[model samples]
Target: METILFFIIVGIISTIFGKSKRTQGQSPKKPIKVSGMEDIRTLFKELKNEVSLPAAPIKSEQKVEVLQKSNRTLEQEYNQVRKESESSRKALAASRLQREKMKEQTIEVSKDECEPSISMEPNAQTLVNGIIWAEILGEPRSKKPYFPKRG
Candidate 1:
């Protein structure tokens, strides 16, 4: 509450002072000008005039020669990298093809190795005996005897 009252009093005082200053036709406070591109450009021009730097040591011919040498070296490096990339790509393709061939061979080997669990069908009696054994092992003996129906 005290803070609120203080803020209100300050606001009122500031407004009163502002009105008085305005009515006087001339304000004591001057309008501030924001710095713009033109101001920055003028400042830059003035700074350039005040501070002078020594000229570069290299002549135009030397600069051109250096630039040409650097360009040639850069082009050579680019071609070398391109050749290396192409060779690596070819190696990758070869490895992929080898991997694919190995996979195919593995699949063929697995097919050749696998054999069916039961090659021949069991006789009817053998099947019945198997069913009876399965029932005996799988379930508990009940009050009524269990028997498999004929197919």
Candidate 2:
């Protein structure tokens, strides 16, 4: 039993020391070179070329001419709008003046029509006669009294 226990302990210590020596004696693994690196670099170069390429350039004179044409058109449009606004304003003022004239004419015509004419005759004479007739005859049996019609 004692010899068996001593052998077991010696075996465990020998395994631990053997593993340390094996690890220390071995060399570290070198990094593997990838074959696809050249393809990636070429693709990056193509992207850089496409990005760095310049667009077709415009001449300074052509740019100036384009700007001048646009400015002229804008000025013409502004003038057209200004003329239209001025004409509309004139039409509005004319219409307002005509409306005021019509209003004044209507006021004058109404004054002439509404004025009471001076006359020596009394307008209530017929009413007084109607009252006298009603008192003499009292109320008639009909809805309307039998009074003589006058034009």
What Cα-based lDDT does every candidate model obtain?
A: 0.86, 0.87
- Cα lDDT tens digits for candidate 1, 1-151: 9999999999999999989979788565766456666798899988896677545566899989999999999999999999999999999999999999999999998997895457387889879988999988876767446685567
- Per-residue CA lDDT of candidate 2, range 70-105, in tens? 999999999999999999999999999999999999
Candidate 1 error regions (>4 Å): 1-39, 43-54, 115-151
TM-score of 2: 0.45
Clashing residue pairs found in predicted model 2: none
Worst 10 residues of 1 by lDDT: 26-35
| Model 2 misplaced regions, further than 4 Å | 1-55, 121-151
Q: Give the lDDT of residue 132 in candidate 1.
A: 92
